[model samples]
Target: MNKPLIAGLLTLALAGCASSQPDQPFSLTVAHINDTHSHFDPSDVQLTLNNKTVYTRVGGHPRLLSYANQLHQQAAQTEQPFLLLHAGDAWQGSGYFKLNEGAMNVDLLNQLPLDAMVLGNHEFDLNNQRLSDFIDGVTFPIVAANLDVSQDSDLQAVENLTPYVLYAFKGDKKKRVNSVEDAGKYPVVAIMGLVLEDMANIAPNIGQAQFKQELVSAQQTVDTLTEQGVKHIIALTHLGLDKDQQLAEQVNGIDVIVGGHSHSLLGDFSQLGWEKNAPYAQQFTNPDGLGISCVVQAGKFAQAMGELTVNFTLDGQVTDCKGTNTLLVDKVFYNDVRRADKHRLTDTEQERITGFLAKQPNVALVDEDPGLRTYIDETYRPELLQTYGAVIGHVPSSLQHVRVPVANQGSQVAPLVAASQLYWANTPEVRGVSGREVDFALVAAGAVRNNIEAGELKAGHVGLDILPFVNAVSLVSLTGREVAGLLLETINGAIGDDTHAGQFPYVSGLRYTFNETRRGHGYLANIEYLHQGEWQRIIPDARYQVVLTGYHASGNDGWHTLFEAQQAETDRIDLAYVQDELTAFLVSRLSKNEQGAIEVHYQKQALDCQLPGVSCNADAQAFIDYVQARRPILTALPESGVTVNRLH
Candidate 1:
């Protein structure tokens, strides 16, 4: 906070009080929501309200509608104006959207009285025709300052859609009715919307639309809205939290930014003051640098609603801000003092949303012809069961499990995938590529997200529960030197002892050694790439192929070396490549077998032999101990070879 500017505002306020002596304060309420992503169903989310543990079931459209009505009523009682604004991504996700092409959620959203809503990345999941159809169903305006929807025929159907919406609310304080000539007071509020630029990159095939820099688009909208004689400006932003903060800092005319995408629960107010010409070409308009702004996000899955209260003087300058971004619970009766039971939902509430599909339109379409929802649900279930042979693996309850804490190194999950890759490679289809059965598969361990159960576990049970993220695989060719370089980078990024061979790439056909003490810079002094049970020093320019997830290939979390290596190969693979080729290859092999099962076994090589002079060592027994003790960890990996066999 700039103390000098605040002091100046205080002085101005005191001088105004001394002159006019204004008696009343004016306030209005803005209720906001974002990243709902079609999770209209209520969620059991925990919150700390007034320093008390409040278990509130939040965010169902019906529940939200009911709460909005209640809040509107309260506002009416207090003679204050209330506006409901949705930040973005009110569509997509869940079985509901997949089943109905997002029309069901659009219908429900239309029922609510909203001032305006912004477009999010997921809104473009379907083509423009479907998006336009959904928008046609909505009663209120949808704005996107950045997206050029004009080029699309379907999007152009919504003629009334504006880049920014200007709302006029009656300000507090009764006007004198002298001589029947006095007019009623009215306060105009302006709202604008903007989408992030990265939508083109992330949601590429969904829509061929592009978004401009968030700050630039917002500035343009501000100029337009301000020129129309509206002073108070609120921005409905779909650009995530970080971008929202940058907007707050870079954009001058914006008063508050209701952001989405990243999914945050923000209650604290953020203030930014103008210091002459701020960075990013922003020119200050507010006098005395007293301008205050805030940015908030109400997580994903419609789990929360954000409400804000701002007070402005008759002169159109905001003087104060109060209240909070309260996340209203769906179950209203739970907080009722008169209720005998603490739980709000009657048995009827539980079943209420479950049968909502019956009343929803296009339900028959999804039921008859399921889309992505059906494919994903069907694909994962059967495939998970076939990957790991054992129906269940039991472990002690006390064993603790977790995701790989390190970024580049192999995790329990990476090794399992590496093992599966090796096992799958020996199949006929892949064997043809190398003209050899196969030797091993190497995987970095950092890809794992969660831990497995400590107790008895099943094959489908573990893989399904553990590796839930939908990531595509990419296969790349590299030389022996490149592999060694990649291994060096991987080892250097590891957290624990690197001398333990098991700690390196979870390998099926490869073995390597590293000196823990010497494994800092130039750590990987030497490595042996194993093929068909024979170890050989890698040739610098020799072409070697390896498979990894698209995320790793893209190097999103900063595996630049891996990304560069993949780029060097120029063999970029789509997600469908692995799903269809490698997965199918494994399935075909498993189906022909009598038992239809694949076994994953691990054996640790002693580091003393590989590391030579280095004393660092972990024997086969030690590795077995690590796997058994960390069964929860070992099970976290994605198991391969689940198949759907047609019964003859």
Candidate 2:
């Protein structure tokens, strides 16, 4: 890890050397924004200055550009060198960025005087080459220590980019009486980038061109910069707060690590000091040799800006520092260009969003319904309509519990998901295009987020509760023997062998059965695989195409065998895509049946068991209680601290 020192020593050499002046004390400002996601509309801004009633639009290139300019002016007046930095995940998310493929945000970012940019996982969603192209259009140097972009076609030139950068400012020097007054090089502000290894696991498809490991790569970057005498080190890290804390523990000499990814709005800017004498030196409140390492991450979006002032000396060392994380709000008036009459709601959404922002509480009094404007703008605002593809159906009943499958039909959970996958794979235009039809689909009952409700929820709520997190459908190629092995593992892990074998699939396209004591795995006796309409023995070496969400494929919830055996590769279909497909399938089913109900049924198997001295029910209940009580560790969140129920 102690590598990459060769390039850190030299960054810039001026053509003309001015005589070195007396060492003077000066201030420098390091400012940054994260997760803007192209909400450039004036409506996104909010302000809460003390007793100042202001209803101003927020979060667009124009507004941000203006704020940046103001900061630059303030820096000049205060004799502090100012530097602008972005932590990461800046290019994707909102309507505008999606519509124009990040052009608007890119244009806006370049318009501001940004010194450096850090690469986030989302930036790779367009694939490595396009990501490189996007980076090329930016004026600042992009820094990421763990991303190996050398192999990418568009980013090869930028691979050799130093993980840390030093910016030096030349300013007038304050002199003591009779002391030689000397102009000083700009305060050297050091920038470094770090990303979590799991970032690859979570955003696999987008991050295929890169690899991430936070601690090791970050330490190397820091050591190199510290050796080069960079005064203040700022980590523009996209690895989230916990990972940032871990980095602070393991590495030393870094002054500040600005973080992102986990959007936490802590409400203020504060410093965390690692203790010098604590057993875990890294997490200590104060470290013996190192000055406190200040870590800050403003909540996501342009919701806030983090400002830190580091006081240092002529020899490149920090003396003392204090600052605040400021919440930026609109303080002026803008015209309402969001009227639906101006253009089609969808067509003018992105532009209109700027005009529709809600008047934040305690800020100003421009409009009462600030949220409505945000909603309208977001739904229609993005220049592109790419977010519409993914939709999923919701069922009211909890699907977690199992029951008997219908005489002629199969498990409802199985079939419903199967139908969705089939629909996703073979649409009117996509059927048999690549000689691959999702022959089989698999979903663990545990993967279902919750019972879909009968009534509708907010679009965001549905996305959050049903889909929860982002996951794509991964197509994995597996042999029948491998499939059988997976099934055997499942059976062994289940309550008992008497439980049905097909139960594990929680899917409808295929079926199989097993007996507990009568047969070994029941594969030799009742094992059967169904496809189309007939029975087929799952050939061990015969390759079968299977579909599963990306989470399982990545072994997120204990699916290591599937990951290893099936050779899973995410097909790049996010959960939103599955949600959309489900919605379409439900609609189609509703139209065909006319009843408008998508019902899924599962067969509950009755297992025969004997406890030497206890009733089966009582024995099972006791055992459950024992296990629940003895569980080594638990982390469960309760809705409330107290509960009340009517007694019968």
Cα deviation of 630, candidate 2, in Å: 43
What does candidate 1's lDDT look like per residue over 108-191, in tens digits?
676566768988888887787777787777777787787776656667557645677765444321211111111112345677
In model 1, where do residues sit more than 4 Å from their true spots?
A: 1-25, 44-58, 171-185, 206-210, 267-288, 328-648
> Candidate 2 on 1-648: residue-level lDDT in tens?
010111221222222233243266656677777766555554322122332222334344445555566666687677556777788888665545546675665655666667777877777666666676677777677877777766655667754344666555543111111111111333455677776566555553553356656777877777776565455677788887777776666677666777777654434221111011211112212233555566666555565566667666665455665554444544343222221233223435433333432322111112222443454356545423343332222222223222222222323333444445545544443343323566666665444433232211223322333333444444556677766666555544432434433224444344455344432233323334557767676776787776666455444344446645423232222122221222111100001125732221112221112323212221112112222333112111111111111111
Top lDDT model: 1
**How far in Å is the alpha carbon of 532 misplaced in model 1?**
16
Please tell me which predicted candidate would have the highest TM-score against the true structure.
1
For candidate 2, the lDDT comes to: 0.48
Candidate 2 TM-score to native:
0.51
Give the range of the ten consecutive residues with the poorest summed lDDT in model 2. Answer: 583-592
* Candidate 1 to native Cα RMSD, angstroms: 16.9
Sequence-dependent TM-score of model 1: 0.54
